[model samples]
Target chain A: MTAVRVIAALALFIPHAALAGEPIGQIKTQTGTVFVERAGASKPVAIGDRVFESDTIVTTSGTVGITFTDNSMMSLGPMSRLKLDQFKFDATTHNGVFNSSLQKGTLSVKSGNIVRQTPEAMHIRTPAALLGVRGTEFVVRADDAS
Target chain B: MTRLRLIAPLASALALSACCGPKDLIVVLPGADGHVGGVIVETGGSKLVLDKAYAGARPGSGASEPVDVSAYEVERVFAKALAARPIPPKTYTLYFVSGGDEIVPESRAELDAMLAEIGDRKAVEVVVTGHTDTMGSSSDNDRLSLERARSVEAQLKDTLAAKGVQSDSVTAVGRGERELLVKTADQTADPRNRRVEITVR
Candidate 1:
């Protein structure tokens, strides 16, 4: 397997861990393993990877994306500072809600069936705006011009 | 009391974050027959039609139960009689009042269902774009569309707050009648086409 796949593999079972000075967070991907480190940790995320929490930065080593158990997908752009502060999804009833904060950069989302099932459960935050999705696809950006 | 004390810090943190963004609840509605409930279009029957072959949901493993989709001519048909049967894919088109952007109480149930999905995520993007029917002047439609979008945005914020979904990651837009699902100028005043489109990202 490639290095990225190897990292993805190690990510899943490691549990939410914060290094000596890292922040708290988790990352999951499609067919890829899950990995997490606290904010400021030197860990890198690539395509098909995700990170959930505050104070983390996305470096160029890997492109990261997040897929909630309910099918909602968010792909973070390169060099972005995004955190998944909260997520609760119950597949039994098709109920999954999420809240995310974007301190900097861009992220694209293709929401899943949960929004159709429950619109109020989804929200996206940026410096200048707050976006509420009801099961449609869109992108949000925050940068110098934001 | 010790347990409560441990949880107090989390609760206080959540409360403090409430002002940074929106706090709303996202709810999911069950399906009746083949169709999931809460659709805006008036249906001939309460049962919804799901293209069984194409219907799919994620965190995908739970839907692997055995159900004969081809037993009948209809690819997929579930009955309201079996409340526990899995829900199928369906669509809903909400309508708004004339010259008003407020979503009626009746619509709250459906909105609640949508919010249930995204509110759980630590971070999500909800793109709520508003629309208006082609009955009024362009300016009026513009204002109406904005009002409608704002109304939905406010409702989402309030609902999320109640459900423990903090704000800070939500936005709303007013598209007016620029993008109508159905053109009313050529057809009747179809309430179905005049409303907002919420895309949870």
Candidate 2:
């Protein structure tokens, strides 16, 4: 943990911020922990952290809420599992694509214009079904088979 | 008369099954308790929901209020995804470095497994968010939170890409230290406050 912290701090010093178009500032959790990870690595998410596809973060308890770059909001409730598979946006074309899957637990989602523009571009999956959104907020939960 | 009696039972059974279709199932809501459970039944074009009111009462959080889960909440649980049957919600708590975006190394294996579970599903929407403890200035906290969220977002996109999942399906955001699990605002820095949250939609 300590080692990762050192690296994360170092990252802020580098000019990578220009490359990633990263958030305006430091990313944190409801618990007040700062965010850190290798530039191309996924950070593990905890309660209060907004989730994203590139990080591939997971939780062990409770729920987390997320607001995407396009202003879409999603919430994940306890024990639920999900992954941000892919997301790409072209501001000029107004084309933003996002996809993910929920393995277990529950999630509530509110889609925005980006998702509405490319309806097929938004996707969420559960243990028994796959959700394709056309701009709406929805929830899903699945039990752990194990 | 004999034919009607036999047909009546069959008709009723069919009707019941119809009401129990996959789209009609209701999900269990998170309770104050540690565990939460819910049930879903299909009714016409809508859904029938059954949930344990106080089933999620956590042991030490003061008194366990009667579980007041709303039918709408139950609906939200199932409404997040599209499926034919009830999908139970799973929970995970993440531990992060203080003032940083790194995850505990030991948690990787579990995280990897969960990632795979979601990655294999082509239609899922992944959400990643970051939060902060009450220890720092709100301005700094917000910056830290977003940085953390972006870091996770990068990681998820990279990992999934390696695993053959497309990278364009994920979304990431930062929420700063606005919400806390333990509620330790004015006094000290709570370790539990340092964390991030992930969800599926």
Candidate 3:
């Protein structure tokens, strides 16, 4: 765990704005080694654990699932790495933006309110592809080299 | 040693490629409701739409193929990821009495049943929204609606706490006459319009 934290932190070569506030989501299910890297600190994530935007989730020989505030769902397969880049929503208006990056491994998603009725509200970034999700279910896979 | 390490990974990658399909790929799956939505996968200055169930494409490739990913391939590739999918959210509606914040007797029973369905979940989020008919003044209706929503939100949070929802968040809002379930003129009352909507996730 400690070694992975070091490598993951080093992998974030670019600086980002400080993110702190209410949690934007929570872990709904997890098995084996599931972690959330936030503010340069790495910690294990259990069900019900709050996750904020900009948190990088890493899974090693395990899987993890999360439900965002807007009701979107994301699940990561084994040996996967994902970063929740940006998320903002107004439950009353159902307007928001959802963006994330999958560095490697596999991901499955179900679009939520923020993107269900609106177009171009959700995007998932991968090494070789950028996906515009339109209120649907999809799966993405990427190897490290890609 | 460096040369051997490089060659070893290359050999393993080649062996893995023989069985695995693409280094970067995407497949659209049918939703829980059986609706197969679409995705625009942009790579190498091109965009490909995967609109049909099990449709797939490879990123970074110049040409896009309308590949219909087979069930066997989907299962073989993303079984664990699919299994990790979270349960979808559910919403329930309960009506209130005209000019009163009280929940109708029949709807109370329904609320009880709704509680049973979500009482055991972890990280439960409940949103209770109160709405009313256009019978009364908008300001008065807004206050009544808020009271009605707060009433249920309090009852629910307290009950859920006792029932031991692992971690929960409750939000209450009032839509009042601004949004009516049943369209009506001013000073009109519709039982259907006096209601509360609850969403559990």
Best by DockQ: 3
Residue A94 Cα positional deviation in candidate 2, in Å, after optimal superposition:
24
Q: Write candidate 1's Cα lDDT for A66-133 as tens digits.
A: 55545565655444556676666543344666777766554555556567678747776555445555
Question: TM-scores for all candidates?
Answer: 0.35, 0.36, 0.82
Task: Give lDDT for model 2.
Answer: 0.52
Q: Pick the candidate with the highest lDDT.
A: 3
Chain B TM-score, model 1, reads 0.45
- Cα RMSD, model 2: 17.6
What is the TM-score (0 to 1) of chain A in model 1?
A: 0.63
**lDDT by residue (tens digit), candidate 2, A7-124:** 9998896776444554311111222222323357645544323343444434444445555655465555555566666767643233777777666666665565466567657766
lDDT of 1 by residue, B32-68 (tens): 2333332111112222222233222111122232222
Candidate 2 lDDT, tens digit per residue, B93-121?
56675545677875576576667666544
Q: What TM-score against the true chain A does chain A of each candidate get?
A: 0.63, 0.64, 0.85
